[model samples]
Target: MQWDGISEFVYVAENESFTRASKKMAISTAQVSRQVSALEKRLNIKLFYRTTRKVSLTEEGRVFYQHCRSVLDGLDAAEHAITNLHSKPQGKIKLTAPVTYGEQQVLPLVNNFISQYSDIEVSAYLSNRNIDLVDEGYDLAIRLGKLSDSTMMAKKLGKRTSYVCASPRYLEKHGVPHALSELSQHSCLLGTLDYWHFSELEREKSIRVSGRLRYNSGFSLTDAALKGLGIVQLPDYYVEQHIKNGELISLLDSYRAPDEGIWAVYPQNRHLSPKIRLLVDYLAEKLR
Candidate 1:
């Protein structure tokens, strides 16, 4: 029988995490993952139930793990943790993200990751609806803002700031709003939400805003603001450069809401495969 991945498998079984097992054995998580995967392949049986959030043994995997642990009672544990760093990560990773962010930011990062790991394949679905990972068989999802209380695990990839802005031409014609209350007097470009979010005196606040035009698209709303049609509130990604070049003027600086997290969320007990885990880390690093 092949002995290549037994130690790695044992460690992962015990710790329920490739990352934790790697640290305990002083090896790369990639090595731990690769070994376990290799062991499963050699045995022609699945070893672990994998999810990005956690890992657990399957029935056959449990039996194998138990057998390995007993055999290890008479063997050196370190001897089982073999070094195999030559294997390139290769697998399919299915994920979902919000439409605009996926198009503008996340998919680009995924492209870079695929460029590095040519053997890995990915399928990304961009939608605003909250997809059930386990039910729909999605491996992971990118979510924005505050996460609701849930059993699912999440990692903050980065933060996004929202800006309330209007074209200088609009501000000049209508007079700039100096206080939150003044927003009522100006036409506000609308999006999916009828209210704009902000912070006032250290407390979160939302103010209802109405406009001559309402569209679900950020680009459309931004265009309306640039054309001096009205003011708009949107995440910085949509307006930061425009503000920088003086196409739009930031409003109520003191009332701007705190930045919200961009997150990578996955189902519990469904541990991320090595390839997906690698992508998550790459996304986190690049996003940071």
Candidate 2:
């Protein structure tokens, strides 16, 4: 079969609108319509049910779309492999990470990666929100805790340990919590999550914690703890130095939760690009 307008047909089918597909593919709406018309004529089928404001694909169109998408994806993988063979890592690698971790850990490594591989460019988005890597076209993402989305492939860069800490003054005034249950009597400073993680009798445990103050930023929660507002649970990186400086005290050592993984996640594709693979490796080494 002729493949002249197959790409346009695929785009329209996926997007469910010629106008939106045209905008995405940077073509005119009329051109997109023309290409789809040509494709339908060649295939000799009614592909779409057009309406005044919407378009719906026919059953036959849906089946054809799946095959076309697979073919295009294969072609893209082959192109990526062929074009980048024996070539230096070059092209923009779009990445995302949590704001605190990105600022404290990932950003420095990313900068060094770019320094070493000058040909590889990076665009990083730092936020706490869960980003859809495939839909957003991210090359990779630095994710903390457990991997929830099974669709993405992940490499463990390192582990992050949560610390229950309080300022020396706060502990002195409110008394230290020797056991997990004692937390209920003490004022707690909370982050984004309402529960805190711990371990009991060699098994994982979670306790619902409440606080007068709650914020999304780890830095803010640590700050509140420092001012003797309440006890807070934060990652080791955020409070280790303070604990060492005798400004904060680490408590509940026996009950500290199992270390959670720090991961570099990317979509599962047939071909993983060298730039992404190398970057993940670099982060794993640097973080370890």
Candidate 3:
């Protein structure tokens, strides 16, 4: 089967107009019509019912359209793989990540990676809001949570634990909460969610924590916690060095928060591009 002809037929069927399909395919309208006609002749089927106003697919055309789509998709994948072999994975790779994670963890590695692979260009966006990878044309994203999209592929890089922490000054004044239930008694810095999820003695738990101070940004919440204002539940990355330095002490050690795993995610593709694969592997190795 002529893959080019089949591809042209699929485009025409999708557009329902030879002129529109030709514009999309960057070919002459006459060439588009010729290719579709050639494909129909080869298949020995009437692929479309043409009219003055518009074109509609015949019964045989619907079946041929499905087959053409599959065949053309396979051909495109094959061509991309072959082209990738000759290419040195040189292109702009757009990535999205949480602000704190991107700034503290990913930024350092990106600098090193770019230095090593001078050909690869990277653009990293640090934002907490979920982005539409396909719509935005992002090559990859580092996501930290449960993935809800079945359309994308994700590789687990590592697991992260949260810590309920407060400054020594706050602990000295307000005292510490020995039990998870006691968290409500103390002032707390809240994030987007008013409740904190945790686990204790093999059982899961949730605590409704309130605070005088609240912020949507994690950095702001961390700063509030550092100022000895109230207790805050935050990821280990934000508080680890502080915990080590005794700037912030972990409270309620017996109760563990729900762990969130870091993942490198990308839109599902027939063949993974070398650039994305390399970066994902590099992150997994570095984080692990």
Candidate 4:
């Protein structure tokens, strides 16, 4: 209800110095001091304990500061909402994703999104490691597979199906794997992971695999598979086109693992800004 001295009082309380608050507000120190004094008189409360060296909040001031800070934050949010309503979604959003998927799938869509909303900018970090969006100050993150962080709020952007496949030349030369056990007989192009996932009788399974070519890169593994170096188990993005073109043959369809969820996750504790929310919706629509 009382707005006259609230801003100046809050500024001084938060900064714990009238001079600093004056500088922040672009006002004179005497004005800052007068406003806060008037606020204390109007409220009939001692808000600050001042000394020659330091100034700090009193018990009443601490309580007032808590509520005042929330009010200011709410006002900021309201202002942002009004601005977004009047204009197109425009802001920088920083996000993270696994390297291969971001490069092959997510980043291209992000490019398309930025083209549509030219005022918006995106900073995407492509990495395999799980990033703490809140701790790292990222607006969003695209993650794959079964999610382990129950604390994160996620939207299912899409699904990624893994394919167990080999080039026609490799299949012809090394013989096709008719059963899960037959994978051991052929040369397997390896990635960072040594285990190939599968599903058998409604149960998920991870079979340990080994090979001569090992790279943390999915593109390299796909190239190795195309060159007929060995069979590979990779996400469909890496091999689906090749399978459709008959350059690579999909194998073990009967035991293929269930499609893993591709998710866009943000800290559950954080607010979803309009730009980020729109971006998430846009991605889900395109991915679908």
The models' CA-based lDDT, in order, is 0.88, 0.88, 0.84, 0.88
Worst 10 residues of 1 by lDDT: 76-85
For residues 60-153, what per-residue lDDT tens digits would candidate 1 score against the true structure? 9988976887676445333422322455678788999999999999999999999999899999999999897755878899999998847578
Q: lDDT tens string, model 4, 24-135?
A: 7899999999988999999999999999988899999999987886787688678778877868787899999998888888999998888888888899999999987765
Q: What lDDT does model 2 reach? A: 0.88
Predictions: Cα RMSD each: 10.9, 4.8, 5.8, 8.2
| Candidate 3 weakest lDDT stretch, 10 residues | 267-276
- Reference-based TM-score, model 2: 0.73
Residues 22-64 of candidate 2 have per-residue lDDT tens digits of 9868989999999889888988998899998988889998899
**Tens digit per residue, CA lDDT, model 3, 102-201:** 9988878888877878888999999888998865778888999789886677899988889999999999999989998788799999998989988888
- Would you list the rank order by TM-score, best first? 3, 2, 4, 1
TM-score of each: 0.71, 0.73, 0.73, 0.72
Clashes of each: 6, 0, 0, 0
